[model samples]
Target: MELDFWQQRWHENQTGFHLSDVNPCLLKYWPLFGGEGLDENKPATVFVPLCGKSLDLIWLASQSYSVIGVECSEKAVDAFFSEQSLSVQKEKSENFNIYKSEQIKLFQGDFFQLSKHHLASVSAVYDRASLVALPEAMRRRYVKHLAAILPASVSILLVTLEYDQALMAGPPFSLSETEVEQLYGSDFEIELLCREDIIDEQARFKERGLRYMFERVFKISR
Candidate 1:
C-alpha cells in the first residue's frame, strides 16, 4: 500500500482500525517488561510507529514514559492533541511536522523517512496496529528498517491478528505465529506473551465472513 491509501482513509473517516479506548492487552501484559528494563541514563521513551491518534500515548505518559510517535497523517496527529485537550508546540523539520505536548511528541510524516537519529532516546516500542497494517513485501521492508535504526536491548510489545486470509481482504491483515517470528527473530529475542480467540468480540470481522480469528501478543527484545 502507498501513503495516500492511509491519508485517504483518514480524510474519508474510514477508520474501523482506530480504537476508542486503551487496549486491554496492553494493560495486562506491559508490566512483564518491568520499569527497570528501560535505560536508566535518561527517561525511557517508547517509539510508536504508525500511531493513529491512539489513547495509548496518553496512558504511557501517565505511567512516566516519554512517547515518540511517527504517523503519516497530519489529520491523525492534530486530532490526537485536540481530543486530548492538549496545548501543542509545533515546529517544522526537514521531513516532518513535529508536535509536542508534555512528554509526548509526534512526528507527522512517512514512516520509511524516519531515521535512527529521530529515535535516539527510544528504549521500547508499542505496536498495536502497525505491523499488521501492511502486505508481506512492505512488512519485510518495515522490519529491515526498524532493525537497522533501533539499538539493541529495546523491548517491543506487539499485537497481531491471525485468520484465514482467503476469507477477507485486509489493512488489518492476518499474521500467523511463524510469520511474526520470521520477521523479528533475526533482529530480536522473541517470546509469545499471550494468545486468545477474539473473533466474537469483533463483530465487523464476523460480518466480513471470517469463521474464526485470534489475537497474538509478543514480547520482542532487540
Candidate 2:
C-alpha cells in the first residue's frame, strides 16, 4: 500500500485494527524477551514499527523498557501522546520528526527509510500489525530491512493473522505459517508460540464467508 492509503485511513478514522487495550499476545509473551522485571542497570529498548496509536507502546514502556515507535502517520503519532495525556518534546530530522517523552520516543515517518543508526539500540521488536499491513511484495523488503538493522541477539515477538485471502481483501492480511518461515527462516530461528482459531471472535470475517481464521504468534531470534 502507498502512503496515501494509510494517510487516508488515519484521516477518516478508519482504524479498526487499532486496539483499545494492550494485545493479549504482547502481555503473555513480551516477558520472554526481557520485557518484565527489567534491571535498572541494563535497560533494553524495544522497537515497534508501523505502531499506529496502539496502547501497546504505553504498556511496553510501563514494563521499564524504553519504547521507540516508528509510524508513517503524524496524526496517529500525535494522537498516541495526546490521548495518554503525556507531554512530548519534538525534534526535526531530514527524514522524520521525533516526539519523545521520558520512556517513549515516536518517529513520524516511513519505516523503510529508518536506518541502523536510528534503531541500533533496539534489543527486541514487537510486531503486532506491521508485516501484515503490507502486500506480499513489500513484506520481503520489510523483513530484509529489519534483519539488516537489528543485532544478532535481538528477538522478535510477532503476531499475525491467517485466513483464506480469496474470502476477503485486507490490510490485516492473511499470513500463513509457510509464508512466515519463507520470510524470516533463513536468518532468524523461528518458533510458533501459539495458534488459535479466532473465527468466532471475528464476526466480520464470519460474515464475509470465511470458514477459518487463525491468529499465530511467533518468537523469532537471530
lDDT of 1 by residue, 13-89 (tens): 99999989999988987776555443343338889999999999999899888999999999999999999999999
RMSD of 2: 2.2
Instruction: Enumerate residue pairs that collide in model 2.
Output: none
Candidate 1, residue 93: how far the Cα is off, in Å? 0.7
After superposition, candidate 1 runs with Cα above 4 Å error: 36-43
- Candidate 1, 10: how far from true, in Å? 0.3
Give me the overall lDDT of model 1.
0.89
Number of clashes recorded per candidate: 1, 0
Worst 10 residues of 1 by lDDT: 34-43
What are the per-residue Cα lDDT tens digits for candidate 2 across 27-62? 888767773532223338999999999999999999
User: How much is the lDDT of residue 7 in candidate 2?
Assistant: 83
Error of 2 at 69 (Å): 0.7
